[model samples]
Target: MLQGAGVVSLSGISTGAYATGIEPFRQVVTRYAIRPNPAAPWPAGLRLRIAVLTDIHACDPWMSLERIAGIVAATNALQADLVVLVGDFMVGQRYVTRIIPAAEWAPVLGGLAAPLGVHAVLGNHDWWEDPDALRRGGGPTASGTELTRNGIRVLSNEAVPLATRAGPVWLAGLEDQLALLPVRRRTGRGRLGLHDLAATLKAVPDGAPMILLAHEPDIFAQVPARVALTLSGHTHGGQVRLFGWSPVVPSRYPGRYAYGHVRERSDLVISGGLGLSIAPIRLGVPPEIVVVELGAEAVA
Candidate 1:
């Protein structure tokens, strides 16, 4: 009887783990309304709804093409003014998960719609596959042609002017710094400096509110106060958190910038992301579609 009881107890434990840890990948939308500091020079009374989707390792086992479609559908339903994809479209190396070609998933990504249009930056995985391929399109890079064909602009160390009701805001995108490293040497926590962040900022006209799209949140340190906000994803909220604490955060400053809104030199929002990496299970921290409402009081 004791042995039978132990089996039942073990089964319960497994069930609980699946419920708390792995089940959060169902894709929950987390909404936030951020009011730019009144003191800042942002255009007054201008409200911009920005939807952010990131870290979509659209491969098999965990993330499938259908899942990607569902995520896009949900984002579209949000009726955002601007939509930004922060990268990591493909799964990283050293994982045993099923591999899906980028072409198969590109059209689905192309389908994402927003009034201001869709913009993206390449993630480490996309860079790891082939940097050249990622830029010009083709190869296994998930974002290239598929995104461009669908009208999603891929920003690589460049800035574009977006006219908002408040005023003209500049959107700048940075290249994946981790792509500069040798694939075998990437530990996921290493510092990335390949992209010229300063140069990207310089392209933006002075006094215009700027929004930066970077894949990793660690770059928050370098952002100046002039840039109103920075959006990023890479840590995945440590992928697993226990009692609100993440045991492993793929970042240099795990304690401070692992997830959520962090204020350094400027305001930063680190999304937990919509897909998984390294493993198929997520605990405590759920997959998220971050809906950020700008020019309003901050709320979660």
Candidate 2:
């Protein structure tokens, strides 16, 4: 009778482990609205829906190509006016048992659809592997040309005006902060210069509202108030939270900008992202696809 009890106890323990360590891999859509700030100028009746997918540390046993397909399919269903991929397309380091090249994931990512266009920016992980390689090569096997062929514009320290029924909105992307680090310490934290920010904003038309895509939320402090919204992902909502508190948040600000909407000088939204890093487990924070809807406030 004691032996039988031991077997049942072990089985229960196994089930609980799966629930805590693996089930959080299941992704969810977290939606938010970006209302026009009184300080920022927005065209009347401007309503733009943007879908953001970031930190897709594509590998095996967890973030497989099949899983990416599901994420793409769901984002397409949202029918967003603009779709932006915030970066970290490949794993930072080989912590997982299985690894998949970025090439295999490109075609799947190309499947993403948005009415206006699909845009992407590099993340720290992309820089960690090889900055030149990531810039010249879209994925592991595919070249940068391949991603462009797929109609995805990979922006780097550049801005483009997107024509909308409401008005022209400037979409700007900054170079990964990690890229500025020294050769041996590229992954370490760094800061963006005001000149770099100015260069990106130079192309913007006067009085046009801007949306910036940056991978790390730490840069939120430097963005000018003129920027209507800044979208970022890198903290992964601390990946593992206990009772809404995360013990390890990978940000200079720690728990402050760990996740969700943060209103600083500018509006910042940090996505929890779609894959895992360091450890292959998530306890409380699940993978997410962020949908942000932008509209003008009611004229009361």
Highest lDDT model number: 1
Model 1, range 1-300, lDDT digits (tens) per residue? 999999999998996789445674577888877877544457777888999999988777677898899998999999999999999987763443577777787788888998788999988877666657534333435565567777789888899989776668889998876764553354544434457798899999888888999998878888888887899999989988888799999988899889888766667899999877776667777899998888787774
Candidate 2 lDDT by residue in tens digits, 260-295: 888777789999898877777676778999988877
In TM-score terms, candidate 1 sits at 0.87
- Which 10-residue window in model 2 sums to the lowest lDDT? 135-144
Candidate 2 TM-score, C-alpha based: 0.85
**TM-score of every candidate relative to the true structure:** 0.87, 0.85
lDDT of each: 0.81, 0.78
